[model samples]
Target: MGILEKISEIEKEIQRTQKNKATEYHLGLLKAKLARYRAQLLEGSKTSGPKGEGFDVMKSGDARVALVGFPSVGKSTLLSTLTSTTSECASYEFTTLTCIPGVIEHNGASIQLLDLPGIIEGAAAGKGRGRQVISVARTADIVVMMLDALKGDIQKELLTKELEAVGIRLNKKRPNIYFKEKKGGGISITATCILTKISERMINLILHEYKIFNADVVFRDDCGTEEFIDVVVGKRKYMPCLYVYNKIDQISIEEVDRIAWQPHCVVISCNMLLNLEHLKEMIWRYLHLITVYTKKPGKKPDFNDGLILRSNCTVEHACHAIHRTLVQNFKYAQVWGHSAKYNGQHVGLSHKLSHEDVLLVTKK
Candidate 1:
């Protein structure tokens, strides 16, 4: 079974524990979400199944980083290079016919990296299984856009334009406003219009230009770039992504230097046996994971429920992630790192957690 299945098993075990009302409620919420996603997976409409599987599996809540790019762009090559899973890599197009998953290790933690089939031109229009690829792209927490360095800047620019032109804004906040004649009597849309602070005229002009004035939209500021457009104009999800320039060994040092200088771009060489370790490190950094450990009596230290947090996570959020009730009824936490000579330090909820910190959360 996958990580999600393992998590479900854990939750089921938690629910089976008699009289643990809180755990049961939490498990119920997780199950409801899982059921909704399973229904979506069985729907099998429009790029549904191929990419849809990722969404269904991911909604059960696992950290996912997706590999996406054009055909023959070495996405599969990179996946095999960085992880234990060996997917078929070819010299020609569409080698990855479906979503291929691999477990990659970084900082002593394993993260899920999905190698999705290539996204070609007219992907949104379902050309050459583009919709299928985009569907996988929609579900990822982080998207790694694998580019053929040999294809050069024109190809890069074209993809960037294509991603942004459809109003797939990245890292922007947009409100989810629902318009209603009565309760649940009209269409529902995710809001993609990010100019929430601007004037009504500006908003109207933007909507007219995008042709989204006729819909009820939900604003998802944290959604992916592609999903941003879908939420605003249609019901779609947006995912966050990083651009990975693959086949770096084929490019000259000077060319590599030029591409590396691109802001926030992570360039890596994937030549079957190249810097695979370094590539995995970069993936971890891109995912924003900081390793920590969970201690259990007489058992080996497990990273499971060790709080896989974003780099920006504070002690408060980490506390909540450990157990929602802890955050609600927080007292103080004792934290100790391997480097620390002290046994532990008592701190408030906002205290930022560090790598290898063993935390004991106390609640009143």
Candidate 2:
């Protein structure tokens, strides 16, 4: 049978199979096979052709955040409200036919926001150009899952599942698993801590399914079988996601409070313009972005134009951000901020920078 047919069959089997110690190995093998087939399917699509219109918008600004949700959930409205870009907003679903790019300027940083076409139920299965939309989302630094307040739970679950199916892990970190392939040595499994969810034998079986016989595996965390498979596939994108509940004005106060209390969630009313500023703040925090000001030898630091860099960024990152060739000079930088030991402390390229820090780089 074809890859899709095989995938469907395997999924059915996995669902029907009982989840007990007796069937653990069987389930593991099936999951590995399913992952392999899905990878093959995605690879085939890569060689298919162009990704089509509007989906290939150039990545710009300090970072990119994708606005993804069901149709008429106010993604377009959010984009328009936050940025100058005018996306076609409507009361009906599927108003956005393609990806529309906008820029949100906040805290001296420009964040590119993309209002993509609304995703349907069978998005992961390539229904309604879902694959294309998700493909663009993978390139983003963060994903903003815009959901209607009334149906926030349902939309959030469905969107999360769709994103997860395509290897987009939201609000998660990459599994702390060290995996390396070898040419001669047989499979070696080691763990820093006790592995409860997966065993060495099961690991070997999963590896053999992928035809990976000679590899070194180290488990740093007690991750599950699926996480191990993701490590093996090594094509997964683990990034932060913000669940944005829109149209909160229509919902009751109790509902809003409950949704707002959830982790990594932001409630807003694009029509009424409520809590939009908080949404911006949440986006900035989730992106882990920090601004650093540059100072001359004698002149004051230029606070008007600050360099936007990721949190825990080093002076070397600042150099690269200023200019690609700035690092070749090989010099130290003076800092005057939280990261600095003292005022105007001379720090090397490896010195981590803090938010709103002042930096003055010296040449060789």
Each candidate's root-mean-square deviation in Å? 15.6, 1.5
> What is the C-alpha lDDT profile of model 2 across 240-348, one tens digit per residue?
9999999999989999999999999999999899999999999999999999999889999998999999998999999998989889995888999999999999899
Q: Which runs in model 1 stand beyond 4 Å of their true positions?
A: 1-62, 161-167, 170-200, 205-239, 294-306, 314-331, 337-343, 362-364
* Candidate 1 per-residue C-alpha lDDT over 188-261 given as tens digits, one digit per residue, 9 for 90 to 100: 44456554333333333434444344645454443332233233344433445566677778989999889888
**Residue 315, candidate 2: C-alpha displacement in angstroms:** 1.6
Cα displacement (Å) at residue 312, model 1:
3.7
Quick one: best lDDT, which candidate? 2
TM-score of 2: 0.96
Badly placed stretches (over 4 Å) of model 2 are: none
Candidate 1, position 31, lDDT: 39
What are the lDDT scores of the predictions, listed in order? 0.60, 0.92
